[model samples]
Target: MLILWTQGDTNGIGSEVILKSFHRWRHRPHRAVVVGSYCMMKFYEKRLNLTTPLVEIESLNDIPMQEKTPDEPLYVLSLSCNIKANVGEIQADAGELSMKAVERAATLCLSGEADAMVTAPIHKEAIAKAGYPFQGHTDFLEHLSQSGRAQMLLCDIETNLKVALATVHIPLGKVSETLRASGLRPHLTALANALTKNFGIQTPRLAVLGLNPHASDNGVIGKEETEFLQPELALLKQDFCVDGLFAADGFFGAKRYKEFDAVLALYHDQGLIPFKMLAFETGVNMTTGLPIVRTSPDHGTAFDIAGKGIANEASFLSATHLAIQVAERRRHLETTA
Candidate 1:
């Protein structure tokens, strides 16, 4: 079974994308179980007018090992929070439900009941206001798994480009310090391994981006690029197809980015700005180095237009598809080896 945990409140587009992805992909052999409030889901079903039925399951054992008939392709393990969410409005109750959904998803993934997990966008401010110490979904999941570091990779299969960030969710002032040798190599290694093992990229070509303007103009603008990044790149190239310290400005040019399989960004915006520009609606945010596979949409919770019923689900749908593909690939490698 593939358990998909959605951050709560059906009033938002999360509910819309959850049902949309399930409806579109339910023909697969695996069953998708939603971990969220039953009432919230039902509200979404009525609002979106989707015909799919959501079943409430007590446990993973309640699901049949195999479907006797081919008609039922999906199931929902509805864990009800029973909270009323005001459409397009942020509230404490909604925040609580979102956190619960995240917690449930992490626990299920850890327990081996779910093959892979896909998370919907959650309101970070709402979550923090509710007293959760999480920086975001990736940080929360990494903390839950007790993993060393979680590498964030944005992939667009159409272009065969996978961009991973060395520093995420941090202020710009700290980006240079964060790009030091102790910080960069581990994530580079993690992304390289994930590409080979899960995505079947045998020799992944990696391009590392420069931190400052024009890669610090060869150390005239900043010395961190030459001091920290160049050394790390040299060490990484020993084991992988790692190349860069390329100037961030020119790296995203049409010719340069297409030359490599993946581009390593120094900071969040340094990479995401170009990434979004290229594949805003088609990208997938995949977390590497996790014990269990996890992916989310490249976008975040659009609180400004939360419940207007106009949020696009393209990124979320792409993320779901990527998670399933990676999970199936991992399963295949395990079975064959």
Candidate 2:
């Protein structure tokens, strides 16, 4: 049984993708129980004309992992807040529900009932406007998991390229301050461990990116690379296959990126702008260093296209598949070890 705790509502692409993906997976040997609002899901269900029944389950034990029929396990866990989810408009009530769904999903995972979690794209601004102090799903989940070392890893299956961010969701001005000598080692260590454990890469070849243009041109532009990044890279090389302090300008050239399994970016835009450009529709955003696996679409809520039935679900679907892959691999290692 695989408990898929979907957070985003039907107004966005989350429920649509979950339903579509469920239709694709229903015939297979798995159980997908949705953790969301019943009314909101019904709204999308009618829109998509979905055939799968939305059974409401109170406990994880209610999931019937072995069955095939209309009677088979299909369900929803409804929440209190309700609003007419305008297809393209962001609403505080919708954002509140989204956050609650995530909170509940984390509870399920921590309680050992769910094997893994696949979250839908969330609108951070909407969430904040709702009075919730949230940066993004990764930060929210890290605190929910009570982990100090959580990291974000991006992978596109088609490209077989994985990139992890050392610092995320911060302004360009603050990235260098965040990438201190004390904190640098833990992010890199987490990246290496997650690459090996989740993606099955042993001795993962990691390329670390520089913070400034031309990698500071040997300290002509900035000193972060030589002062902080290089020493950390040197320390990590003793036990790991790691290299870099490569200039951000030329690091993405064909010859450089192809040689490494993953690139470690100094900050958000330094990494994501290029990543999204290259792997926009196929990327999977994974949260590493958590006890349980969690992944989400590399994209965010398509507010303009929300409720239009036109938002692309490819990224969200990719994230779902990646979550399953990593969880199954981890489960296998646990079984064999």
Per-model TM-score versus the true fold = 0.92, 0.92
Q: List model 1 lDDT by residue over 274-303, tens digit each.
A: 888888888888998888889888877666
Candidate 2: tens digits of C-alpha lDDT, residues 1-337: 4757575844577877777766666676656677778777777778767666777766667656556554464677666535676775677777888888888888888887887888887777778878888797888988899987788998888788788898888777888887774556777789888988997888889888888888888788988878877777788789778888887668776548778999988888878887888899999899998988888888876766665566676787788778888888998999999
Q: Where is model 2 more than 4 Å wrong at Cα?
A: 48-52, 68-73, 181-183
The TM-score between candidate 2 and the true structure equals: 0.92
Clashing pairs in 2: 55-75, 87-306
Candidate 1, 305: how far from true, in Å? 3.3
